[model samples]
Target: MSELKEQLKSQIIEQLNLEDLTPADIKNDSPLFGDEGLGLDSIDALEFIVLLDSFYGIKIEDPAAAREIFHSVDSMADFIESKK
Candidate 1:
């Protein structure tokens, strides 16, 4: 689980081109979107969807559903775990 979290963190930073953030900077339960969190927008959300499919082989077609599941790193991990 820790390995997955670390890999996800690194992937997120790399995929999103967040040059300023290290994996240690992100909390496991931190919100990934909105002003209260990473400030990610709709584009980031789309990227996350792509990330899911590309990295995890999880295909999420509905934008609304994706929004709910991809709300935070923890949530995304949970979703991925459920899928597995």
Candidate 2:
């Protein structure tokens, strides 16, 4: 799970073009969006969907669930493990 979280941080930075942030800068429990977090917008949400499919071979069919699944690196990791 820790490895997945670390990998997610790196992938999110590269996928979202967050050049200012390093993997260490993103906390596993930190929110991935909104004003208090990474501040990612709607379009970034689309990129996140793509990132999941391309990197992890995971597909999110339900948009509503994405809100919970993509909440943080920890949640993403948990979701991935659940699928396995």
Residues 1-84, candidate 2: write the lDDT tens digits. Answer: 898889988999999998889999888888888986788767788888999999989898876568888888898899889988
| Alpha-carbon lDDT of model 1 | 0.88
How much is 9 displaced in model 2, in angstroms?
0.5
Candidate 1 off by > 4 Å: none
What lDDT does each candidate get? 0.88, 0.86
Q: Tell how far residue 73 is off in model 1, in angstroms.
A: 1.0
Q: Write out the backbone clash pairs for model 2.
A: none
30-58 per-residue lDDT for model 1 (tens digits): 88888977889899988898888999999
Model 2, position 41: C-alpha lDDT score = 69
